[model samples]
Target chain A: MAKVAIVGSGFIGRAWAISFARAGHDVRMWDQSRAATGGARDYISGVLDDLASNDLLRGQTVDAVLDRITVVAELEEALAEAVHIQENTPENLDVKREVFSLIDALAGPQAVIASSTSALLPSKFTDHLEGRHRCLVVHPINPPYLIPAAEVVPAPWTSTETVERTSAFLVDAGHAPLVMQRELDGFIMNRLQGALLEEAFRLVADGYASVEDVDIGIRDGLALRWSFMGPFETIDLNAPGGVRDYVERYQTIYSNIFPQMLRRVDWAGEVMTTVEADRRKRLPKASLGDRQVWRDRRLMALAAHKKKSDREFGK
Target chain B: MAKVAIVGSGFIGRAWAISFARAGHDVRMWDQSRAATGGARDYISGVLDDLASNDLLRGQTVDAVLDRITVVAELEEALAEAVHIQENTPENLDVKREVFSLIDALAGPQAVIASSTSALLPSKFTDHLEGRHRCLVVHPINPPYLIPAAEVVPAPWTSTETVERTSAFLVDAGHAPLVMQRELDGFIMNRLQGALLEEAFRLVADGYASVEDVDIGIRDGLALRWSFMGPFETIDLNAPGGVRDYVERYQTIYSNIFPQMLRRVDWAGEVMTTVEADRRKRLPKASLGDRQVWRDRRLMALAAHKKKSDREFGK
Candidate 1:
């Protein structure tokens, strides 16, 4: 098992601890706050138990997996002998830069320092570091315990060895590692999501469809295929002649609708509020916590099903 | 049980027959080619059995469901005593217009003449019909027995009564129905899909990512939530304060990337070929037919899981 350090014991940090531990890596977790670090073990244990209840526990037993993670009070102790360090601090650039600076000094010479920032580019925080060549963004989906795809993005000066080694490390940890060609705003997942959300907001703002209708259109329609296949794969299987045939038949139509997609919607305006109001009507503020639990459970079930199906059918 | 006529017994029409029949509707099917209509019953039986194998069959037995569909040689006979006539002809406008004209004359006045055209607007085909008020587009995902979301788009002149009745008919047939706000090009499903495709193509073309990496990004990352929840609800629950909060944080980032999404990609160009080549590497051309079967089975399993999960946790 590899030695890994998870810096910042917040929700994502704790999740990274579980992911590494469950993959049989010895995970050392550290947080700036002593109270958060002290609570990390129990929090990780509770979440692991919840996953076990859903038949989503990664390893033999919760205790066996829990035994692999050590919650260290000091950042230096956490990074002392680590092969890789996963930094999950706040989204602010200043915080990330400070944390990475500390990690770069404390981490071993060969250790890969990976940031879990969803929005910020790796270069924003890692460019000035001594070990910047080994530093890259390894963005995971929220609650990485359920979703395993991690986007591995490298800065301009980041070495090819860093990308390859990090990719291998993620795969070894049972995560699907997707290495980006270069750093772009929001990366692939959010960019695709952003495109759809832009149109969705525009559709609502333009008074074309309700928020509920928009959700229904996806969950009930396109998502059925999308859950298993990507957009390219979906269109590939759409026509007899496959992707090219699909494009020839429908490119003009999509082009016509592309300009109609809203470039900018006032986030604080009626459009956002209308969608929020519609969402609240379905799920109120009081039940957000419960809905989150429900979402996690459903995610566990889906992951389990996907795992079984992939085994049955070659991925 | 409602009496439904499935005109043009192709893959979609036959699948519709099973959807309605399994839900206890008496289905009459017809195709212009007698040879096509002749083998439809057996073809449908095989698919129904496949769904049964996956524990996705709606009714008591395969034979019991199969007993409800009858393949008729004559179009007039098929349209006789029908409440809903689902037309699944070629995507060609002339073919649709000609077929709908025949169906409009032959079918009863109360029947909802719904076309299963994926990309065509309903007005293009049904505007001149005497029963145009009773006609609209009810586009189904292929193999509707497995994926039940049908895109219900109405022509400008179509009646509200037609929309309500058709929606009821679809739900009764155990399908989730999404009604479009108006007759837009490509409708809701394709428009959402097209937006994603545009971004995906541009990403690959611009060297932001490979074809495979883009697909992996969705199937592994976003599709997990999207399978059950739509984009709006996903972003709603993403942050504690809901969608407005998410937008307030990330709106500018998404807006920055929106213009980069390619407006048009030539179908016959290098981009399409490269994507197709990548897809072909993963799945060769010869294996496409078998892959289609595998896809259908996967859909069935997902449908079964979704049915049970939605029941356990209220949708």
Candidate 2:
């Protein structure tokens, strides 16, 4: 197991620590705030307890897994023995640049430094670094312990060897890493998310459907196919012959409706109010924690389902 | 249980017959072609056999369930004792118009007329009908036996009472029915599908990732959250506070990328070629049927998992 350094003791950083440690890596976590570091330890313990209860952990003892994570205040000590450094500081560009500079100064020559920034382009953050060749972005879905996909995005300056090594390391740490051939805004998952949200916002703005109904369109409708297979595979399976047949049959209708999707919404204004009001009606603000728990449980059930069925389903 | 009549004994029509019959409804299927009706009976029997192997049915006997489904050649005979009519003809506009006209002429006043057309506007087909108030589009995901979600979309002229009755009937039939507030092209499911396909095409076209990686981004990433909760509920429960907090944190990023989705593609060309080539690489044309069966088995297992764990962990 590699020694992994996790900078910043925020929610995402702590998640990365626990995920690495649970996968049997020796994880060193660092944060400027002592309180943040202390909170992360408690959070990690709680998460490990949750995983143990669910029988999702590979280790025999939660203590054994927790013992592998060392919460440190010194950045130099955190990066001293690490093979890869995962930076999860605030998403501010200036903050990221400062952190990456510090990381390059303290990290060993062979260590690969990666960020958990969701939107910031890696080139902007790592361009001034002396060890720019060894830096990239490894974006994980929230609660990376359960959801194992990571978008391994590289800047133009980032070496191919670094990308390959990072991919191998992430795979070894029990993550499915998708390599981004070029850096783009939102990467892969969020780009698809953006598209859905655009249409969802447009639908709500037009009063075509309530926020709840739009959600049902996905959760109950298209997402079922998506959970198992992707959109291309879905359309391929939908038509008898293959993609060609699917296009032949549905292309006309798709073309007819394609123009409607080009209609964009200002997601920042009245649309937000509409969605917020609708969502609040379904899930009250007071029950946010309960709803989050509900979301996690659903994710667990879904993960369990995918584990049992996806291979058989050819998804 | 309602006595359901399935008009047009194509693949979807026969599947509806078996689904309603499996749920213990008496089903009478009518096809213009005698050979098609015979084929539907055999197909329904085969599907029932598969369901029996999986312990999905708890009937007196497969023969008893099969006994409930009678194949009739005449439209009047099929609608004789039927309480609900499920029409699944070809996707031609004139064919839909003719079928609706015939159904309006033959079906009882109290019987609900629903079309299985994925693309046609319900108003266009049923506008000329005497029983137009009783008709609406009840679009099911393909192979409705495995996927239980049905979109009950009503046109501008569709009555509220009709929509409510259809929703209630579908619920009783063990299906999740989401009502569209108004008519729109592609309704809700396919529009969301269109949104996803647009971005997927853009990603592949821009060379951000391989077709395979984009598939993984969905099946392994966002789809995990979506299979259990709608996107609204997903974003609602994602952050610590709820949807409001999630938006506060990620809205800027989402807003930044939302414009990128506005860029449209002519999906009629090279994009199709790229996706087709990618699909053939993974699953050849010859292996599609076996793979589809694999998809069903996976869906069954996934559904079973959701059934089991949702009670325990789904909150």
Candidate 3:
């Protein structure tokens, strides 16, 4: 097992701790505020209980996996023997720059420093670091213990070895690493999700469909197949001759729709009123935390279902 | 039980027969080409066995569900006492228009004529029918028995009663109807799907990511959450508050990336080579038919899983 460090022991950092420690990595979590670091183990312990109940703790008891994660008080100790350091600092450029500079100075020469910043591109912060070649973004979907897909984005100066090693590390930890060639705005998942969200907003803003109708189109339709297979594989198996044949039949339709999709509705603009209204109508604003918990539970059940199916149905 | 007529006995028509019959509807299927209609019962019988094995026959023997569907030789026989006539002739406008015209004439005044055409708009085919007020589009994501989302799109001249009846009819068949306000190209599912696909193609074309990497982003990442929830509900439960809070925090990130996304990739042009090569590398041309059957089996397993989870999880 590798030695891993989670620099910011908030949500994402602690979540990473569970993932790494479950994968048999010794994880050290640290935060600037002692209060955040102090509560890290408790928060992780609570989630570990849920994971154990869901049988998602990799066949280990809650304490067995939880034992590998330690809440360290000092940054130097956290970075002492780290092989992969995942930075989850606040999403400000200046803060990330300062944090990376500090980590670069303190981290071992062989250690790889990865960021969990979804908002900033890697080049923006890693450009000033001496170990920039070994630095990249290993952005994960929240609660990485449950969701396995993490986008590994590299800067222009980031070395190929770093990308390869990070991908191998994630795969070893039971995560699917989307190794991107170069850093782009929004990376892969958000770029894809942004496209769908933009269209969803336009459909509602233009009065063609309600937010709920658009939501049903996914929550019931395409997502059912998408949950197990990618879009490429979905379309690949759609037509008789696979992807090319399916494209030959249906790609023109998307091409025709592309022109109509050239327009965009600002997510926070007028569409927010309708989107928020529909959401609040379904789920009151006060119950968001409970619903979030419910979503995580649903995710856990889905994760368990996938694991079982993968064994039964040859993933 | 309602009387339903499937005017084309192809893949979609037969799938709809399974859906309607399993819902205890009396389904009659007819096709213009006798050769096509000849195998309708046999094809459906084969699929019903798979459905039976998966326990998707609504707690009935395969023969009980199969008994509800009958293959008729004449169009008049299919449309005789039908309350909902689904025309799935072909995607060609002329074929749909001619077939719709014939069905509208033969259909009873109280019956609703619904086209399963994914390509043609309802107005384009239903405009000249005398009973156009009772006509609309009820496009099903193929194998409506397995996937429940169907878009109930109405022509401009279509009455509210038609849309409501279509949606209610679909709901009775256990469908989550995306009842749209009016006819639009691509409808709801395609509009949402098209947007994500455009970004997918753009990602590959721009050298930011490979086709497989883009697929991993969805198959392993967003789609896991999406299998149970929609984009709105996803973002709703993501932040501390709700959709508004998510928008307050993350909408700016998407808005910043929107300008860069004001671009398009030619699906049939250069990108086809990369996409097809990537897909063909994973799956050969000869295995597509087997894979399509595999996809249906996976869909069946997923359908069963969803049913069980919905019962246990209160969805």
DockQ of each: 0.68, 0.69, 0.81
lDDT tens string, model 1, A184-253? 9889888889878777777787776788777877887788777888778887887777777777877887
Give, for candidate 3 chain A, the lowest lDDT window spanning 10 residues. Answer: A238-247
Ranking by DockQ: 3, 2, 1
Tens-digit lDDT track of model 2 for B210-296? 778888888778888887787888887777777767878787787777667767766657777888888899999999999888877
TM-score for the A-chain in each candidate structure: 0.96, 0.95, 0.98
TM-score list, all predictions: 0.97, 0.95, 0.98
Top TM-score model: 3
Worst 10 residues of 2 chain A by lDDT: A306-315
User: What C-alpha lDDT values do all the predictions have?
Assistant: 0.85, 0.83, 0.88
Q: Per-residue lDDT tens digits of candidate 2, residues A1-315? A: 889999998989999998889888899999988988877777788888878766667644789999999998799989987999999998899999999999999999979999998989999999998999999999999888888789999999999999999999878777888899979999898888878887888888988878877777777677877877877788888888998898788877767877787667776577888888888887788888877777776776566556546455444
CAPRI quality of model 1: medium
Q: Alpha carbon lDDT of residue A51, candidate 2?
A: 80
Candidate 3 segments whose C-alpha is farther than 4 A from its true place: none
Q: Rank the candidates by lDDT, best first.
A: 3, 1, 2
Off by over 4 Å in 2: A310-315, B52-64
The candidate scoring highest on lDDT is 3
Candidate 2 vs candidate 3: the TM-score winner is 3
* Candidate 1 structure lDDT: 0.85
